[model samples]
Target: MRVPRFCCFLLLAIAASAYADSEIPFAAFELADSTDFTTNAEKNLWLLAEAAATAGDTAGNTQRASLDLRWEASLNRQWRAGFSDRVDGHFSQDLKQSDSLNTLREAWLSYRLTPQTLFDAGRINTRYGVALGYNPTDFLGRGTVRSASSADPEMLRSNRLGNAMIRVQRFWDRAALSAIWSPKISSKPATSSTSLDWGASNPRNRLLLSGSYRLAENLNPQLLLLQEEQRSPQFGANFSRVLSRQVLVYAEWAGGRQPLAWQEALPRQQWQVRWRNRTAAGVTWTGENQLSLRLEGHYNGLADNSRALAYLSAAAGSGGGQNTTPVVTEWVAPRRAALLQAYWADIFDRYDLNIIWQRDMQRGQNLGFAEVRHHIGPVDLALQWQKVFRLSTHSRVLAQADRRWQLSIGYFF
Candidate 1:
């Protein structure tokens, strides 16, 4: 398998230097095996072909070994640096060279201009929003995914590339302000496993300004303004309140003039722009027994299910040929959806249970995921199950598997 040799060497050098100073870097290794049962969607030849072209084979088993490393150090008293990286190797009957992937999730340096002021430069994973399932205000995470190993939203968000940017922030007793600028680097995404695909993360010059104020002991509200090249500026807000020690509610919203989702997926389509809003609101409750439950709702005003299905139908009818540009299936956000999650930590002495269920309110599709994990010292063992229903003719083919099962064991060092 091809590895990013130079990047690996640089990381090792950094780790060695950190160790020389008597600091230990965090590291973990994990091995996982997964089996998938796929449903036959061949009733629609076009959709079947499209799914094959974009989603790859959905019915198979694979084993993977992964290493995750993270390090943070203080360089003198005013400056600091941090790095995060992950590497994965997949082994299976159908494994390909590209299946081995390495991601430099974050590498940045920060300078504390004052006790409450800081400046940061380099690739940084700047995440915003306060929702469990969907994040409407995460403007910088549009197309940054390089490899996906799981359908869990938390895993997906943690395993993606970060954008290269310069940021400045200042903090007060009960308020904070920040600004960021990320410049366009490459014009197209890199396809090689070892290439640092900057285009996927920073496709356009962007600027973001955000501020937050604490209005009460349990209420802090954040406001944001984002501008990107060749696009209308978007406005965003996040608010959360704690009703008591056991309950909390939160909401995130973003709005801007944008084209329809389907129009952005298909090529040469007439582009129309209008004010659109996306929102996610959720509430979580935790009990004394250590069981936490959450409920969330999402809305996407730009998503047009009818238009999306029509475009797929037209492409299928035209026999777009195998060489036809692969349709963008990742744009399949439901116009309305709901998510439910449950977590019981230390249900047993050392076991944890986590469950998630999401429904596409508009099309009546459903997705369910559950996991049980056991911890033993520095080792963890986990089993995961996922299933999807009523998604045969939908554009969300990535999650089209009928069922999937995964077992993983991890060790920490």
Candidate 2:
């Protein structure tokens, strides 16, 4: 279970940060359901398991299982603390790289410096890792935010070690700036589970700087930028409008650099766009039901290349400050070098679903994927399935799919 230990730790802490409550039945507990905590000594728990067909390479079956504890408590009005712990494992063909499983995800603390300002510095989740919480003010969508870190051995920000410097936030007033510093924590060289392992990945530091501004009573615009030393600079922005009290619409654009021809000497570039809609479907016993529909497309001209950075940039890469990494030639797209993707989703008070399709011109590949999630009481459950029908660059058959299931039980004191 190549579970990133630090990230597992964080998730567990989140699951553990529950308020006291009735104990769950042993049957349900064993089924990997969550159990909320009611006391300081007691904590909530989350368990997840997903079975897959045609996963990875083995051409057989695959599975993922994990347990997490989440918690949140007030030290006082001016101070609050949070803790999360996660433990997970994966199983597949006894391949040395993919066979074993293990990880410990999170451990963090957040303190309020003022009503409008605060500080979070610790082994925190970096902004460069996931797009989910990066919105600064609020995020009304389903599914996790993707990060370049995914191509690295690390799945996402998970745990690792570093400080996260966050500034002011205005959820209701209408503006925000959020920055994160995410660096690879691999003690040794590692390969990504989903990318081509061209040997030890070019380790580097990654940074993200994002801001949101309210331009009109109904419109809000956001700008985000990310840079990885020796690799390339990534820039993106989103414009969201409140169509009504209950309806919100958005447009987003993102671009990343790729190495050029000999310029392959230089990093190539990648780009994507999105249109989104969000609405409310009333509230459940647990939380608000925020629904969203999004259409997105992506293009990558940087896929193939063989240059390595002598060092990666640590400025944004190191977390929030200065950092660096060895330069490595990032992936480059063939002469055609263009990829496109589309997706749609529906979210309701206790359930959500998403559908996606993608096509790559240069590589001549098409892919499809879907995800579903269910929430009950303090318990959150999710199911995800993905299939890639065709790909020209890779040797393995493009037709493949994986099923993933997750459960999280949380309560706050």
TM-scores for the candidates: 0.80, 0.50
Candidate 2 wrong stretches, greater than 4 Å: 1-57, 92-100, 126-174, 179-207, 225-235, 244-248, 254-293, 301-353, 371-384, 389-413
Candidate 2, after superposition: displacement of residue 115 in Å? 2.2
Over 55-126, each residue of candidate 2 has an lDDT whose tens digit, in order, gives 433245444444444445557787655555444445554634344222223345566665756566434333
| 168: Cα error in model 2, Å | 7.2
Top model by lDDT, which number? 1
Assess each prediction's global lDDT (C-alpha) against the native.
Answer: 0.66, 0.34
Per-residue CA lDDT of candidate 1, range 97-190, in tens? 3266778878899999999999999988777875766778889987677776656666666668899999999999999899999999985777
Best TM-score among the predictions, by candidate number: 1
